[model samples]
Each structure stands twice: as C-alpha cells, then as structure tokens.
Target: MAKLFLLLFTLLNSSFLFSQENTLGNEYCQIQLISTEKSPSVNPPIKNLDKEQVTLLEIPAGKSRLRLNCRLDEQGVFTFGNDEILDVSWEALEVKLVPLAASSPSFLLPTGTFSIDFVFLTHHNYKQNFVWEPIVTFLNASLLNNITMGVFYGLCLTLILYVFFMGRVVGDTRFQFYSLYVFCAATFFLLQEGQLNIFLQQQSFLLSHQFYLLFAGFTVFTAIVFIVRLTDLNTTWPKLTRYGLEFGAVVVLLMSVLMLFLNHNELSALLGSAMARVTLLLMLGILTLVSIQAYRNVQSAKLVLLSLVLMVIAMVFRTVLHDVNPFLQRYSLIIAFAVEAFMLAVAVSERIKSIQTDKILAESQANTDALCNVLNRRGWDKKVNEILSEQKIKGGVICLLYIDLDNFKQINDKWGHDTGDKVLKVVSDIIRNQLRSIDSIGRVGGDEFVALGIFYDRTEAENLVIRIQKRLQAVSLHIDKQKTVEVSASVGHVIYEEPPKGAEVMLSQADQSMYQIKRASKQG
Candidate 1:
C-alpha cells in the first residue's frame, strides 16, 4: 500500500493520463436496492447520516421496509423516477425513503432527523407500482451532472470509433480489442447513470441492476484481454502470473453468469467487497506488467502505463478507498476516462507505426545479400531500374560497370580457398566503397560483379570507371609473412543517355565490353 501511494504520488506529480467506467453503486447513480423482506438491511450506509429502522404497513407477513434516518444540509427538491439517485448518491439526505410513486415526484421537505415519515406520494398513487415495478432508479439533481455525463459519454464514443476504424485499416486485431474495451468501459458507466431503467423499467434484469453488473464483468474481461494483447503479457509474464490472470478471467466469467440469477443484495455482494478486492488485485497485477514493460523501454507500455495508472487510482479511491472528497468522486472518473482515451489513441498510433517499420524491415531482409550486406541480384536489378527510370525522366545518363577479376581462379588455386574468400570480401568492399551510396552493386557470378550509377555524361562515367579500376589494382594479399599476391580486375563500362529496354540489355553490353578489355590485355 505504501509503495502504491509512493508510486502514485511520484507519477501524479510528474504526468497525467486515461479513464474508464464502473459501479459501486455504479458511477452516475446509485440504484436504491429496494426490498420487502423483514430481514437485516443489506444496504451499506451512506456517509453522514444516522440509522434507525422503521417498518411500513403493507406487507405479506410482518415484513418491514428500511427507512434511512437523514437530513439535507442545503434546501433543494429531489425528483424520483427520472434521474435522481446519482447526484444525491454522495449527498446524505434527511428524509425517510418509502416505496411510493408519482411522475418524477419531488421531495421538498424541511431538514430534520428521526422524526417525520415525509409524505412523498399518496398510497393510492402507489397502486399501479406496488409490485414488480422499478420504483425510482434515476433522479435529475442538476444540469452540471447532466453535462458531465454528456461529455464523458461523447469522449468514450469518439475514442471507440477512432480505434475501431484504425484497427480495420491496419488489419491488426490488437487495436480491435482496445476499441472493444473503450466501448465496454463507456457502456458500463452508462449503466450507472440509471438510464437503462428509463428504457427498460419493466425488464427485471435491468431493474435488478444485474445487467449493469454484467457489463461490469465484461469491462473487466475486456480490460484484462486488452492489456494482455497490448503488452504480449502471455509470453512475457511468468507462468504463475499468467495463471493468475487466467484464473481471474474465469472468475469474472463466473461472476457474470451469477449476475443473471442473483437478487439485488446477492449481486451487490458479488460486486462488492470480494469482487472489488479481486478487481483491485487484477488492476495492480496489470500495472505491474506495464511497469516491467515500461522499464524495458517498450514504447507502447510507457505510453499506456502513464494513463492506466490514473484510471486505477480513480477507481480505487471511488470504490474501495472511502471518505474521499465528493468533488473528487464526481470528476475523477470523468478525467480518468477522457485522458485514458487520449493515451489509448496514442498507443494505437505507435502500434501502427511499429507494424509499418517491421514490414519495411522484412522486405529489406528478403532482398539483401547475406555475405556482402548489400543488395543481391534481385534487389540490385530493381534498384538500378528505378535509378534508370528516374534518369530518363530527368534527362541524364547512367553508368553500368561489369567487373571480372583477372586470373581469380589461378589466385584461388595457388593461395587456397580461404585466401580466395578473403579476396572476394575485400574486392566487394573496395568496389562498394568507391561508388556513391545510391549506386547499385551485385555479385552476378563466380568472380563476376556488376554496378550501376547516375552520371553527368559518358566522360564522367568513363572517369569513374578509371577510378574503380585503379582502386582494385592497388590491392595486395599476403599469403605468408614473406609471400604476397597481386589483385586486379578487367572492367567493362556502358553509358546510356537514352532509356534502355531494361537492366538485362545494359548488363549484356557491359559484359561484351569487359571481354574485349580482357582480349586486348592478352594481346598486349
């Protein structure tokens, strides 16, 4: 706990990041777990209010309804049935809550504790809503809450669509998981807003708040999978860590299924202490992984970890860490979710760049020569053709050189293949070093090499050929402490002002020129 606080303190001081959705009671509203049982209260007490139990008249047996002992500090009217529970969820009210109904009923009672059974709506008015109906899940407290929720929902939706389409364009499933998480996260928060009851008041699943919880389970699942995929955690994590995560996932799935059958209290237990602890541990575990990856300088991890930490902190303070400021509780998730969306977008962009980089590297490796570290025949031909095409467009000439090492086989026989191999390496280095970096070279055959370069004209082309020949002739190989052999090459050159049919024809002419040079050397 100390370490967590220390880390959070340091990070919070330095940077800011992402957000998510939730329930505790969920985020935007608290569903009053209304019950008719003559049993012990299942509701955790809202802070700053005294507790005293009162029984209502209407019941199957001597069953009683739980009445909250409360008083409002500031005078204000509270509505029922339309958007009420959330804004006042943090505010301890001073009125006895009873099962009654009216079209967005308002409570404008004077402040007092443990006194009056405030008349909310007439008993005759509750006739249609006495059984099997969601009494009041939402309350409209203020427009600020409304605006806050609107902004939160909008940000979540925008990020969701952005990441989803990016995944499609890039053809990477990692982005898809992230996008799903964004949506799950947003929808989970929406569940807490009690808007679901507005649309599905008749549906038991929504009224029971099980559907809200089901999405909570989904949020956990998606968050887990998203991190796993993003960090490649399965491969990177130790076996025990991996198993723990897997186990957590199974727990979430089981819990989700349980939400379907459990009553409000049972579901609350499922989402309450035990589940919150499990979720906290899961979040900490993921944070640990992101930390390790960030340590290794994994860029995506670094980018996401910054934002993810804020979200975890917001969730912890909102859920498990009690007695916090009401203001922090209200806006923490909002800030966290918005910033998290931004970071996720940043992380997704980095992933796309990484994919592109890997692809280009793969293509380069496919076309490269293993021994020479330059282009092989296939790569050389393609590059030379591109250069030639550019030269044709720009109205310039290109030089092609066909170089054949003189008496290369004789040198191999006298000096052994080891020296011959060394000679080949040195020869390739010499030719490559003498040419422009953009020029193309390839080992065409045994002791045969080719090169192509852009030139101002035939004069510049011929001059470069002379320089290459001189550089090659200046080489000497030492076979022993006292023994040496000379290295030389016969060069054939072609300068093309007009575009050739292809690289093959240019190479053929250069080869013919080289053979002529060899024949002349023999006569001389």
Candidate 2:
C-alpha cells in the first residue's frame, strides 16, 4: 500500500525536475577528440564530436584509441573505463573503452601499465563504469516506467493472492492455472525491463535471454489452458479446437524448455531466438482463431477475445512499434497485463458461481421423487437427519410420521397402475396440506411414506396426525368413469423429546408402531 502511494506521489511531482536549473536535466557535456588515434567504430576519426551519441561494439585488444578533451560547466567530465592517464595541460584523457568482460580477471592486477616488469597486473578495472547522464534526468525519464512497473507487479501479485484465497473456498481448479499464468507473465516482464540483476552472481536475467523466452512461452501456455477451461472448450469444440490448442501449448512450452538447455553460441543463440519468435507467432495465431470462434457462441468468451486483442497490441508496442511512441513502448505491456488480469479474475469468479449453481440443481434433481412430487428416500433421510441433528428442535418435540396405505396393492391390482400412482400423489398432497410448512415428506416405498415435524407436545402431534388421516380419508379421487377410491393412510408417529443419533432409529420405531395399527385394523 505504501509503495502504491509512493508511485502516485512520484507521478504528481513530475514537473519538479524541469523547474530546477542546476539539474541539467536535458543537457549533454561537450566532448572533443583531440588526438588522431581513433578506433574504426568511432565515427569521426578525429577532431570535434558532432551529430548524435557514440556507441562502441569493441576496442582493439591493447591499443589506445584517442585523447579526449571533455568540458563541463567547469565541473568537468571523465570516461569510466580502463587504465588511462590525464595530461593536465590540455585536460586530455586517454580513451580506451575496455568493458568489464574484456578486462583482466585478477584482483591483484595493477591499474598502471606493466612498465614495472616485477609486478603482474592482476586486479579488476575498479574504475567506475557510468554513463554521462544527470541523475535527475535519469529519474525524470524513468518516472513513468517506474510507476508502470510498480503498478503492474503490484496488481499481478494482488490478483494472484486473491485467486489463491478463492481457490481455498471453491477449489484449486478455479484459480491455479490463472494465477500461474499471471505469475509467469509478471516474471517475463520483469526480465524484459532488465531490472532483475544480481542473480547468478551479477548476471542479469537479460543476459540469460533463454529464461526470458522460457517465461514468455509459459505465460502463453498457461493462458491458453486457462481459456480452454474457462470457456469449456473441450465439451463444445472437442475435436475441432482441442487438438489445435493442446498441440500449440505443448509445442511452445517444449521449445521454451529446450532453449534453456541448448549451448547458445552465436549460431545457436540466433536459431533459438528465431525458434522462440516463430513459436510465439504460431501460438498467437492459434489463440486468435480459437478465441474468435468461441466468442460467437459462448458469452463468457467475449471478454477473452478482448483481452487477447489488447495483449497483442501491448506486445506490438513493447516490441515492434517501440520506437513509435516512448510512452507506449515503456508502459503498454503493463497496462495490458493489468487489464488482462482483471478480466481473467472476473471470469474465474463467474466460473465458480456457475459451478456452485449447477451443483445445487444436480443435488435437487437427485434427491426428489417426480411421481409423488416429494422427497425421495435419500432426500427424506437428509432432511430428517438435519432436523434431528439440531439441538434446538430436538429439545422440543420432533415427530416422525410413518404412513403406509392400507389397500395400496389392492387399488393397483383392481384399478390398474395409473390409479395407484394418482392415489399416491393425492395422498402426498393431502399429508403436505395437513402438516406445517416446516415439516418434510418423502415417498419411501411403493405405498409407504414418511414425514417429519416439530410440535408443542404430544397433543399437537396427535392433532396433526388426525388432520392428515381425516384429509386422506375424505379424498374422493376418481379412478375412472366406473369408480372412485378413497385416498387414505395408516399414519404412525414417534415423538422424540431427545433426538437419537441419526434418522434410522426413529424410523424403525415409527414403522413398528404403524405395523401394530395396521394389524388391529385387519382384525377389526
């Protein structure tokens, strides 16, 4: 949070640098090559420096290039390079551009020439290797870049953590791939900015370009996988897109891994770069094609298509059109990443919501009896167990009503199966109507049903049973033009003041009570 505020504060103070005259924010020191000895790479072989900055690929093994007279605003200027001398007469310094890699490895080496033949030059070139840019100018130029990098990394990290937290709630599949994708992308961009130095003993990730390619490829691979899962591409375009997407992701990933292991000499490095670029192009083509097709039918995919297009534009600014606009080149990828991460995060939440909804509907369907319009045995046990498990309801009176039709098989035999089904439906409706809304009913058998309820006492429980029985007895459900059958049940209930462990014990006691009622009725 503090870092985020710092970034904002830096942006707000952008005009401060230009107002300071002592800063020399836009000025370059005047330099002149006075001596005629000049390296071939140096443009003007002699005299005054003009027209643009100088960059050297290499300086000859041991030969000195030239003598330079650099004039500052009386503060003076000097080159950060190898062992050289300054002639005070003309303020002239020898120009010998020996980069660190080309210098001696010995720490004991004398900076002075081996004119003292008794001693070996064994020490590193400890001289400073800094460019001639004012500190304020560097900060001013890099202000936007610093802000962009901070926000980009900050947003990516926050989203990753958010997704992981959600993963714990919903499940790992919801956020794992998406978070990994973001992580790899963040790493790739960090490498691109060349900010991650000092790893592998001062070798910047910029030097190991393979890691750059590696992470870049991984970002694409995980992104494709995330999209495939998010849009449910397999179930929809199984054969059409499945092979193409998987193949592309796998090939790109494989090539990226391969680049890391290869011995990258000049030719190898060239080939590896070419391979990485080609794989990227191939994967992007595949991604674009798949996303466009998915967008037409899948509503969720519209966001995905937009993210991909925006990402492509960001990449163009970061790479191909970098010289077109400095702002776009520096911050375009960061903007793209921020937008893409947000869109993906939303997509993931939607997926979680959809999964939960589907699960609920599936459970409902599985535990319901269509014919009776009531809970099936599974759902009955579930509801009863829930009621019994609650200490509050169990402390009062929980009545488990076991209902069995007296002549259900007889009705089926005499009036045909349709009449029997209608009778059961009618009986379920009558029982439901008699009981309170909090009560639950289920069809446990062909003609056996169970219901659960809470009441004030035994009197209230008996009153409910009486109402159900009376309603069932009074039902004159017509079977056909020839006859009508009375919809009735033998209802036996067991009231639990202190609920038992589970549902089955209460059900067994109620079933026994019902059998006794049925036996006495048969005798009468």
Candidate 3:
C-alpha cells in the first residue's frame, strides 16, 4: 500500500510540471516583421510560401506599412510594433485592421501564413518591438491598469468633494477655485492616461484629445486664480499678479480656440503641451515669490510654499527623468498632487482660524479706550446692562460711584496736554487698583469716571466711596522739574437695593447726584 501511494504521488507531480512547461511555451510566441514599399492595403509577396521560405525580417523606422508573421498554437491577443493591441480570429481567413486616423491603415492578417499587414499613423525614430502573448496576459495587464487608474481617480474625487463642501462652509472663493482646479486636473490626467476611453466607448480619438487640452488649459487658469486669491497677490504683488493673470488667461484662450478649430496633428499637440507647461511655470514662479514675501507675516503661507515646492519638484522629476521606472514615472504626479491638496486644506483651515482671532481683537479694541487702555463708555454700558440683567434675576444691592476731577481744565492749561494725559493714566491705574476683579470701571467723559460694584449695605458703599476719595486726593502728577500738579475729585454715591431697569437710567441718576455734590463743594 505504501509503495503504491508513492508511485501515484510521483506520477501526479510529473504531470503537473509538464503542464506548467506547456502553458509557458504557449504563452510566449515568436513574431517576425518585414517592411514593404507597398501600401498597407496591398498583400505582400511571400503569402503562399511555406514556413521555411519566410525570412527573419527587421522592422526599420519611418516605414508606413510592414508585414508581421506570427505563429500560434492557439488563439491569442497580439500587440503590434506600435502600442495597438488587437484580437486575432483563428477561423477567419482574412483579418481587418484599423488605424488611428483616416490617413493610417489597419493591421490586416491572413490565416494560412499567420501573416498580418501592420500600419503606422506616426513615424518613430527608434526601433519597434512587438509583444505576442496569450489573451489571459492581456486581460491581466488591463486589470492592473484599471486598478491603478481607479485609485488615482478615487483620491482626486475625494479631494474635490472635501474642498467643495469646505468652500461652501467657509464661504471662501479660494477653496472653490482650488476644487475646480482639482477637477480639471483629474480630467486632464484621465484623458492623458487613456482611462476615459474605457468608459466613453463612443468617444472619438480626436474629441478625446481635444478634451484633454481643454481640461489642461482650465487647470492652469484655475490654479492661477486660486493662488492669487489665497495670497492676496493683487494687493501684495501687483505687477507680477497682473502679468501672471494675463499670461494664464491668454494660454487658456489659445488652448480653447485651438481645440475647437485646429486639426488634431503632431504640431497642434506639441503647441498645446508647450503652452500649458509655460503657464504652469509662470504660476509656480508667482506663487513662490508671493510666498516668500508673505510668509513672515502669514503662517499659512509657509504651508502653501511647501506644497508649491513639492509640486514643482515632482513636475521636474517627471519631465527630466524620462528613463526612470515606468510605474514610478506614472504615479509621481498623483502622489505629489495628493500631498499638495492636503497641505492646501490645512492652510485654508489656518487662514480661517487667523481671521476669527483678528475679528475678536477688533471687537475688543472698538470697546476699549485707547488712551487709558480701559473700558470706554460703550464698553461700560454693555457691561452694566449685563450686570443689571443678572441682578434683576438675583436681586442684590449695587453701588454706582460717579467721580469728577475738580479743576482738571486748569491743570491741563497750566501743565500742557502731555502732562494732563499722564495724570489721567495715573487716575485710571488708581481706580483699577481700588476695584475688585468683579467690579467695572469706565471713562465716561474727559474728566469723569464711573465705578460699579456689588455692596451689602449703605455702610459698605460709603466706606468704599471714602476709600476711593482718599486715594484720589493722595494722587499727584509731576509736570516738570520745577512744578508738581495736585488734583481733587468730587464724589456722588447712588445705592440701589434692586438695580435699575436700564443701564442708561442708572447712569443718569448717578450723574445728577454728582452735579449736586459739585455745586455744594463750589459753595463751600
């Protein structure tokens, strides 16, 4: 039983090895090429001959038509010396070939000799190599290409959706322009890579080529707009921004007109690519300059600068290093673009944060007194209104001390405005020091100030008022080496068990009491 089992296992292993060898042999086939002076539609001279009569032919450059003889044991897909792939029918005696354009011819084959006539739409200066493989190999290659293209498009679409929603949320035109730029860029790449051809089965080669140029033009145009808006280039780099915008607009217009009117030819394609590249360089230069100028003041500009630099490096690598690995060359731009989009998103978020901070600071400045760096009348009114509202709910005793500097005009006239300003700052500091953190103080007039605080009773309010008066009396300002100015203040106190209905009404009542004390002091 053991010997029989070993014998069966050995036979099975041998069979498997033999099958693998046969499969590999069938997968790879030999092809021979013969250039002919005859037109692509004409049959070559060696069709009726046996396999020995067919000589090994070398395919030379710049020839329009060639005869390709390939031997196959089974049906297979074959790629010609050019990049064109076609399906072969074993049963059909004659094969029909199609060319890229009207002037080109199709690759047609006859079954018996295993021979086909190949045509070229464009002449190449280098030698041509043909690929012959089983149909399964072709399918595998197609699947791989589909996966790569799908990943690229997926990333681009995600960025588009993200930026589109963010643009609407932030109400920023720059984000909108960036999203448009990304869409155009993705479309351009899809057309360039031939991924769109798979989906648009009815699209003609001419229309596809034209759409590629159109999207490329718009990509550069929108990128310029995005950078200009992001950096405020019109205001910061006026001359450069003006020139960049004009150049980008001209390039886009030329591409659009060319796509509509011009014939699809090598010359037109070259011109379109050249114009697009030049516009990209111009945009990069403008962004680099703007970033350098603004980076010191704007933190977000640093990220923008880094993204631009990364993109420029990727572009340079793709253009200059043509001999690099094919897979790396194909994906370098996609990777660079993804990194750049992420950085730009971060920069936009940072810009929004900065704007919010500036708004808060501006509000604070509007309500603050510039001279004393304390609350102005407007700020004090708002603060008192908040307090009054709170007191209405939780009724408590509140005290308002209205204080006025006596003979302030006389002191200002004698010592000059500079010394008068210094004296006011001293008074403001003294008032701030005397008040609790919860209390509020404001400058309502040139020489009048108000202090608001919570007190338990009339005795506590009177004690607080006396303390403030004593501090004001002790304050003195030195105007010069020869002179010192001293000032006195008249105080009026208003105590409320329940706060007034409005901050304005409370201020009015306090002002009247202050004037009564001022008049009585003048009489004394």
- Model 3 per-residue lDDT tens digits across residues 192-265: 66654444443365334456567767777777777777767667768867776746666775765576566535
TM-scores for all candidates?
Answer: 0.65, 0.71, 0.68
Give one digit per residue, the lDDT tens place, for model 1 in 483-504. 5878989988888888888888
Ordered by lDDT, highest first, the candidates read: 3, 1, 2
| Residue pairs with backbone atoms closer than 3 Å in model 2 (clashes) | 106-122, 107-123, 108-122, 108-123, 109-121, 109-122, 109-123
Question: How would you encode candidate 2's per-residue C-alpha lDDT over 1-524 as one tens digit per residue?
Answer: 99999998887676565565455432333332222222433454423322122222122222223343333332211222222111111211332322122111111111222111111111111121122333343344346555667788899999998887787777757478889999999988776664453133334434455677788779878887777777767667677556777667777787778767764344444545565566667557556665765657674677777777787899788657755764686578778878988998887877677767887988988899989879998898888877866646446678888899988888899888988888888788877887788889999998999988877677887788777766655467775566788655677878777766668888999999889878877797
Error of 2 at 33 (Å): 16
Over 4 Å off in model 2, which ranges?
1-26, 29-134, 140-148, 164-175, 198-201, 204-207, 235-243, 261-266, 392-394, 455-460, 478-484
Which stretches of candidate 3 lie above 4 Å from their native place? Answer: 1-5, 8-12, 29-176, 186-207, 257-271, 280-284, 287-302, 350-354, 381-400, 452-470, 477-484, 493-501
TM-score, cand. 1 vs. native: 0.65
The global C-alpha lDDT for each of the candidates, from Candidate 1 onward, is 0.65, 0.63, 0.66
The 10-residue segment with the lowest total lDDT in model 2: 115-124
Alpha carbon lDDT at 435, candidate 2: 78
The candidate that wins on lDDT is 3
